[model samples]
Target: MINKIRLAIRNDLEASAETRQFGSGWISGFLALVASIAGLLLLLSQRYPQWFSMKELALIHNQTIFSFVIQSILVIAFLLALINLVLRRNKILGFSAITLVFASLLIGQLIDPQEQYIANAYALGFDWFVLNLLLTGLLFIPLEKLFGRLTDQPLFRSEWREDLFYFLISSVLVQIISFLSLSPSMFILETTGSWSGFRLLVAEQPLVLQVLEIMLLTDFVQYWFHRLFHEIPFLWRFHAVHHSAQKMDWLAGSRMHIVEIVGLRGLTIIPMFVLGFNQQALSIYILLVYLNATFVHANLRFNVEWLKPFIVTPRFHHWHHGIEKEAINVNYSIHFPWLDKLFGTYYMPPHQWPKGYGIGGHPVPNGYWKQFLYPFQKKKKTK
Candidate 1:
């Protein structure tokens, strides 16, 4: 009996090894494809600048095929290191290497020529990446450890590559859309007017007051739109992709359907346009929203028993992604807790975390484009 058990364990290990090997090969192939396309586009942009159009050339210039190549190389190296560490059961070295890579990327970005990259690369570095890494490591790391102890599931044990792939694809799509949509007059209108308004708003307010106003307004809009997505079945299908994530983390927030992303942005901008908030206020608002949204979805735990009634913390948003029927359509607020409280949708019973996450029954396509068109597809028969 003991010999049979040993044999079974050995077989399981072998299978797991084969699976990892397959996944690594797949990732390598995909990266190669990305590199090839980027290289071809770069060559075309250089040799046939007139045929390619200014925007097309700018896309290549802004992302700089070089940056993508570097990122891909780093990702491959990290994956190989991770596999070795995992097989050797060396958690400390694994995490240390991961942190080192992230820090190195940040340092590289900081020193790079800002003009070589798109606006978002700079925005990502200064506005989102640095603050998030610091906050996550300081606050979230311990919280995740605590959660792991309680739940028997490591809060941070999620597939980072999947998250990275989603980001790369979405970013590529966004750049393509921007290139196709570019109009000098429209650019002037968006940048000059909206940014000017954002600046003026912050200029008049105290720093603390400015932060408060930005948080309140952005969350208020996000709450309503989030609820709308749930209430309307058609919209729900697209939004459902977000809820489909079986695991939650800071990067999990990027799983949103492309249409939902564009739609939500359009919805959020209405108030910004009509009210005319200055660029500073807008900048601060964007920064706060991105950070808070990342915070709430992060693999963190906070013993803020008193604050739960006011702010939308990780505990609150986890319930929003809860797999249970009663938990569905609850906890809609993005930052503010009062909105969900007012609507009576907030559901976080004491001493309980959700059994699982994702839609209870409905399954969706996995491919990017298929998921993009999912809302328009015929509904599958629900079990």
Candidate 2:
């Protein structure tokens, strides 16, 4: 059965590749240039601090030079390999562009000209980067694989322009909202008070016990937030944009509406605000969410019948995304199987998988702005 599933996946990927024409070498060259520039910046920063002004160095300090370099290398490599399976689509370019932005931010964070080597010492440290990388890989890759499988249908395939625009608009909107909502107290609340309770609760607990408590509490909050989107009509309009995706991949996870992201993150922040989770626990939770959410939506096929009843698996969440009559409004839990089981939203048959997955009723707009304004517009009947 596993071999057959693998064969099916391979065939699907091949079909997708045949339909999509990618510019592999062009992407590789672009990434190579980024890598070279990153390398040069790192070298120059280390070699000639005297040449740069104090402000210039401070700007550089905030940017993560090494992380950018590593990111560029990974992106370039991924694009080269990606062209073999997918079209020379904007999705790959979009990833590269976003990575570049993030890299720039990391660089800025690292290159404190005033502090110089001190900034570099802290900025380029291997420990945090390694932890982040491991966490990201563990969470996103598997989810990407699951999304791939769920989105086997051609209609679900993503359009680059639409996605890129949506992401940009959503991010900007969220930032604006955050700014408007900000105050001195709020700012302090956001940074300092966010995770205080969690820390105090688990301060005396063993490391392993703390980790378990953190995961349980975090997942409990996420599960309800997810279900609320479905149960609440107004919120569903915004979240339906995410469900509109007919196809799923790593980028599928990125297709969320801006408002949805803000709302979800806002809700998640409450626990941090009230509970007082430390930086380390919060970091671990972030890592777990990134990996678990991505893994559940990824294209990888693995059967874990024994584990299914305990922890949420790809098969479990895939069923949530499933388009079948029975699958809709079920499997609301994000990480734990018991949440769904306890709530009675779980719906996996003994020997069945969903034929497809997507929002059944809505005809969501394709462009970012269109979707952003979609909820505001009167609902039109989907064909």
Name the top lDDT candidate.
1
State every prediction's TM-score relative to the real structure: 0.61, 0.62
Model 2: lDDT to the true structure: 0.56
lDDT by residue (tens digit), candidate 2, 1-383: 65764444334333454443235333343343334334334434433334321222334543567445544544554454344335433343333434444554466457543444333321322222223334554565445445444444342244534543443344324324343333332565667754566558756566566657767776787788888878777777777777776655444555787767766776666655345555676677666777676667655565768888888877787788777778778887777889887888878887566677676764786777677787777774331
Query: Tell me, what's the RMSD of every candidate?
Result: 10.2, 10.3
Worst 10 residues of 1 by lDDT: 121-130
Over 4 Å off in model 2, which ranges? 1-157, 164-201, 380-383
Could you tell me how far off, in angstroms, the CA of residue 259 lies in candidate 2 after the best superposition?
Answer: 1.4
lDDT by residue (1-383, candidate 1, tens digit) is: 65764444333333343343443332233233333333333333333333332332344544556456546645754674465454543233344345445654665555443354233311111112222333544565556656632344432244444454565455445544333333332445575664665656656777667667767776788888898888878778878878877788766777887777766776666555445555677677777776777778776665578998888888889889988887888999987888887888878888577877888664876656666778788774321
Off by over 4 Å in 1: 1-162, 174-203, 380-383
> Residue 381 deviation, candidate 2, in Å?
9.0
How big is the positional error of residue 324 in model 1, measured in Å on the Cα after superposition? 1.0
